[model samples]
Each structure stands twice: as structure tokens, then as C-alpha cells.
Target: MTDLRELQFYATPEHPCSYLPRRQAKTLFVDPSAELDQCNYSLLSDLGFRRSGPHIYRPHCEGCSACISARIPVNLFRPNRGQRRVLRRNQDLEMRISEPHFSEELYQLYRRYITARHADGDMYPPSPEQFDSFLIRSNHHTRFYQLHHHERLVAVAVMDQLDQGLSAIYTFFEPEMAHRSLGQYAILRQIEITREHNHPFLYLGYWIRGCQKMAYKTNYRPIQLLINGQWVHCGD
Candidate 1:
């Protein structure tokens, strides 16, 4: 295991909170110049850190501690009725995994997802450059999984295959297919994929309490939340 304490971290200046309004947010990131790899990523993730593009970061707010790292202990996760419905709903689609690469098909789906779902957010004006930089270009460990329906791409899930588990970086799906609930379905499939690789956990990134956007993550039972620098069951 890497001794993350010995590594340098750079904290960003205060910025507007993305989840909670009327608040400021700060983040601590692993120094970009550091020798980051799968091993370091695993340790950092275990320590409540997460990756965005190529930079690993975590909430470092001065006066608040609402953003907590969350993960599913895959072995103990049992899909609730809604999740099981998602599984059955997407069962007709084919799942394909590929190394990170940019394509018009994926870009189109991403654009639709952002425009309809996050038009009010920072990534509202999504572009090819941003997509390439954020999802395509990364450490060689990144993988892109696609859900296809009759040979047409419907969703894309970006994940980082770390030493101990898979980190779900991002996921985008056809906005018109909201009835299928592809977002939650993708995570369920990811949990199965991680289990197939013998990985013990599926890092779902930060889950901020009282943030409606993060409420769905709690649907996955037996989740671990980083509290006071230690991993513990959320129910506890």
C-alpha cells in the first residue's frame, strides 16, 4: 500500500459549491507531478480520494464536511426492487468494453446527456475537446464501456481500473431513454463487472448528504462512506 501521507497534495482555492448552493468548496488534489499509478490510485481511493480526468482530488472544504467518499462493497450488495427492474429493463442491450478512445457516436450521446441533464452546470457547453480531455485521454488504465441496443450506442460508462477496484469516473446515456433508467442500470452492471474481476469494491465517488443529486447512490445497499478518515457502513 502506498503511504499517501508522504505524498504532496495541492488544495485549490475556494470555489462555488456544485452540490450545495450558498456555500464555497475547496478540493485537495494529488500533485500532478507525482508518480501516480494504479497502486497510488488504490491507496488514495481507500483514503477517500477520487479522480477527475487525470487529476485525483477530494473535498477539502474549511468549515464543512458534507462530501463523503462512497463505495459499494460489491460482495454484499443486493439490488433492491428498483435496481432489479433496471437490470431487467436493460437486459436486451449488449455491453462492450473498450480502451479509452474518442468517437462521434459517444460524443453525441454525451452531448445529449449534458444538454438535457446538466445544462445549468459547468460542463453545460460540452465540446469535443472537453470530451477528449476528460474521458478519452487519461492514464492507460481507463476503460470505456458501452451499452448498445441493436448495434446503436445508447450509453457510455467511463471507469478506471484501479489496483483493488474500479472507479466510476462518469456515465452518459440517451436522454430520451430516461424511462429505462440507464444511469442506475450502468452502475449495477459495473458492480457485476467488478465482481467478475475479483475486485472487492466499486467506488461511486463522493456522496454529499442533503444533495438531491447524490441521493441515488444510497440505493446501493451496504455502502461504505469515509467518515473521519475511515471507511464505515453508512447505516452505522
Candidate 2:
């Protein structure tokens, strides 16, 4: 058996929960520059963390079922009719997955995406420093995928590589490119990447049954839920 490891997670005092209505929220994060191996990721994923930059975090709360870890079986995955259309729509775009780096254009598009999609939201305008600290500071198995539409940055996705799967940290896209359904396209691309790499799963973090912001992830069929510390297939 692989030996367990330890890491520190820091968080705020308390704040209103984003996913669960009327509930408080808090986050405890470890330094992205810290050592994190495949075994560490396996343990953390089991603990309910998705991934962000190099940090692993789950919803730490007094009481809440609003957050659950989710993943897609890459081997059995298939692009539905709609997903195919999204792929077709983004055929002209180019994707590059590499070490995380902040760019002005990427930041500008991210700001627009936040303002247009979540203006009234808590993380409306993430400062440049915050964005850097959130994504580029990681020293572990973290990567950023940038999608370019004919040399113009259109979308970006931060992810973590684990022994069994890939975890999508967060994604942002140009608001004007909404018609392309970049979000779904990104997830599909990740599935393809995961499959090519022989990874069995694509961790999507959570699937809140009623949250519109999170429900889109569930559209990917043949997902597995980590319930009671066991992987439960939603279809079978």
C-alpha cells in the first residue's frame, strides 16, 4: 500500500457558501509549490478536492451535501450529438497544454468572462496578483491548457494530473465566444487528452444536482460518483 502523506491547508474565517443556499463557506489550501505526487492526488481526490493551480481543496463546512467529487470514465466516453457540434465549432481553434503562465490577453479575456457571466458574483474581478497566486504558483503536477482561435486567446483551463485521472481545476473563456460553447468544448478536449494518456477518469470536481453553474458537467454521460469512499457508477 502507498504510504499516506501530510500537507497544510489554509482558509478564511468564514463566508456565505456559494453552492449551498444560506450556508457558510471556507477554503483551506496548501502551497502549490509543495511536493504532491500521484499518491497524494489519489488521497486528496478521495477527500473531495477538485484541483486549483497546485492546491487541492474540498468544501469544508459544518453540514452540506451540496458538494460532491465527480469524474468521467475516459475509456467509455463518447461525444454526444451536441458535444460533437461543439467540437466541430471549435475545429478552427488550437490548444496547447503547458506549464501555467499569466498573460495580459488571457487575463483580459478572463475579466470579460467573469463580468459577463458572473458580474453579480463574488469573484467578479480577480486581481492580477490573485490570478497569479491562484494558477501559476503551483509546483506540483499542474498544467494550464490554452485554446487559441487563430492566434487570439479564447479560453483557458487549469488542471491536475493524478495517477488515475485528470482533475479540472477551473476554466475561463471569452464572453463573446459563448456561441462556441467553449466550456463544453474544453471538457471534451480534456476527455480526449485523458484518453490519449491512458487515464481512466476525468475528475470534474462536483455535480450539484440543482446548481445551474455545475449541472452542465453532468451532461457528460457515464460518470462515477465517489460515495461512501467507493466509486459508484451513476448509470449502473
Candidate 3:
């Protein structure tokens, strides 16, 4: 519904791929100060661009196209036996939608998670400043969905409400609770929330084949991959 040409985009210099080590990656991003209007942002998402804090961007590699944008058609989703267990086990979790802001509890959990799991990635050694800039919402459309257990905050999922669907931007939880598979639970809960709002798709961001970090995404069966500007069912 918005004119694509009315906005400007800048592609970043090639950097090492975060998902695929041997390959380099580039990104195309919009000028947040100039062209980050809600209309333009919505269109960018339809074109497969995702947001990290304030920057709305998508992979723009020249030779490699491993980073494929993926989404779940909520109406078509069927949780497997394992996923169903994840739901029933997490039935006691309390979910709340709130404004995007800084919280000591969330920050502590984020630090612990990154320190234990993603120390080798770009966001290694998380700090308060990095936490604020990477997870905080700048354009003002992001909503923080917090999951609590027995009144103790356990997980937080950042979601962006888009024109076509709800974008599951990022999530972090208590690293010690790894047995509960909090990451998978977060997605399932988001899907239920999407269904309640009548959203057709639940954007799951980019899924790179051969990346163990991204392998879990495939478990959400019947997902659609955006390839060559067309969406094809992964199940097909």
C-alpha cells in the first residue's frame, strides 16, 4: 500500500556471516530518521526486512542466499507431540504485554543467556548499553511479552506487529531453565497470540540451512520460505 520508491536504503559492507561462518554477508537497511514511517516499515517487512532494535534490515549477500526469510501460516500450523507437551508443561506460565523498556530482571537474564550460549557471536559479553540498543524499540511499535513462572519473570519475547503478520523479533530467557525448552515455548505462545488476533502469518525471521542454531526452526512444520521473491511451502 505504500510507495517503495519513496524511501531510501543503504546496504552495508560485507561482513562475516553470523549463521554461516565461511560466507560473508551484507544487509540493506532503511534510514530510520527519514524513511522509517509506519507505512514504509510495514512494506519493508513484506519485502522480508526485519528489525533489530532500531535498524530495519534484510540480508543482501551477492552470491549466497542461505538466509531465507521464514514464516508460519498460523491457521495451517499443527504442533507435534513434543510441541504439545511443551505447551501443557508450560501452562502455568503467565504472559503479559507491556511497553518496551529496560528492566533489571530482563537484563540479568539476557546477560546470563548471552554469556552462556552466544559468547562466540557478535553480541558476546553483553552489557547494559548493548542490551538497550539491541532489544529496545525505537520506532515504537514493538511490544514486550513477558513470561513469568510463579510470579518470577522467566522469559521475554519481543514482537513487532506488522501489516501482514506478527514478527517474532527476539527472545531470551533464564539459561538455567534450559530443561524447559523456553525458546520453543516462546514461539508456540506467540503463535497462539497471533491466532487470537487473527493474524495470518507469524514471521520467524531468517532460517539458514546447515546452521545448527537455526535447525530448531524446521520443527515448526509446514513453514514457508521466501525464495527468489516467492514464498514456497517448506513442506512441499
Candidate 4:
């Protein structure tokens, strides 16, 4: 077993905050040389660290604590009327789980999604290299949940299977099908999948209180937020 205390961590110099404007942000990263296995990765996740490609990191900004890690206690989650509508609207989509790999079909969808949805973000002007590095690169625990509608592939949710739960790494979908609410649907599916595997939680990454992009995470009621080094239930 890897001793948590033995792991080396380094903090990056403050950079502009991605979620909030004007404020700066700093990130604490686990040693890149450190070998990460499912055991250690899961342990790190419990401490609010998130994986970005091969690197594990957590927000360590000074004088700011807006980036809160959020997770859903799967068994305690109850979909509200809006979420139920999202599920019903996406009932036609079929989810296929597979190992991570590079494919043109997947790449094109990702490009289109990024182009249409996140063009102003850092991930704008997407490239195959960026796509490969971000999503294709993974450890043994990673899985891609591809959502299909008939013969058309609509969305992909990249996830990591951990000892106690599943972490949603990232998700991208057809921007034109915004009415289907694919992003919310993907998360609901992840919660179902977590339950199917008998996992206790579904890690939803960071939730910034005022960030519009992150507001949807709160919709998953009964979420637990990692606050002051403890996971506290944030009730609906």
C-alpha cells in the first residue's frame, strides 16, 4: 500500500483562475514521477484531488476556497422533476462502455462539441493532439461511456473507476442537441452506473459557487462537498 504521507507534492505559481475572473489560482500537484495505481488514485480522490490526464492535482489557492470538490452519495440521490424530464428525454440514447482509445469519429464529435460549446475557453481551437492527451491518455481504471442514438454517436463521458466510486473525468456532447440535455443525462447515467457497481459515490469534480458552468452540479441533490478537509452533506 502506498503511504499517503510519502507522496511528494508541488504547488504551481499562481495563475489566472479558470472559473472566476480577476482572481488568481494556484494548484497543488502530486509528483508526476509517482506511480499512480487504482489504490493510491482512489485515496487521493478521497482527499479532493482530481486527475487531469496523467497528473493528479487539487486547488491550493491562497485566500480563496471557491473550488469545492463535490460528490453525490449515489444511494441517497433522488432526481427532481427537471432531472426526471432530462432522463425521459434521453431515453432513446444507448450507452456503450469501452476502453479509452483514439478514433476519428470520437475526435470529430469532440471537435464539433468544443467548437460550438466552449470556443471561448482554453480548450478552444481543439486539435487531435489535445483531444488525445486529454481524453485518450488514461490509466487502467479509466472507461469511456459513449452515448449513441440509433447509429449516431451523440456524446462521450470519460470516467475513472475507483475502489469506492466513479469519478467523472470529463464529458462532451453534440451541441446541436442541447435540448436533449445530454450533459445532465450523462451524469444521471453515471449515478446509475455507480449504483449498479455498488459504489457509494460519484465524484463530480469541482463546483464553484458562482460559476454558471458549475451550477448544474448542485442539481444532483444530497451532494457532499469536501470542506475544511471533510466531506459534508449539502442538502437540497
lDDT of 3 at 183: 96
Steric clashes per prediction: 0, 2, 0, 0
Shift in Å, residue 115, candidate 1: 0.2
Quick one: best TM-score, which candidate? 4
Per-model TM-score, in order, reads 0.96, 0.89, 0.95, 0.98
> Which residue window of length 10 is worst by lDDT in model 3?
31-40
Model 4 — TM-score against the truth? 0.98
Candidate 3 displacement at residue 6 in angstroms: 2.0
Clashing pairs in 2: 10-29, 32-139
- Poorest 10 consecutive residues by lDDT, candidate 1: 1-10
Q: Please report, in order, the local distance difference test score of every candidate based on alpha carbons.
A: 0.89, 0.79, 0.87, 0.93
Off by over 4 Å in 2: 1-14, 26-35
Off by over 4 Å in 1: 1-5
Best by lDDT: 4
Candidate 1 Cα lDDT to native: 0.89
* TM-score, candidate number 3: 0.95
The parts of candidate 3 lying over 4 Å away from their true place are none
Worst 10 residues of 2 by lDDT: 1-10
What are the per-residue Cα lDDT tens digits for candidate 3 across 116-158? 8899999998999998999885684789999999889889999
lDDT-wise, the better of 1 and 2 is 1
Candidate number with the higher lDDT (2 or 3)? 3
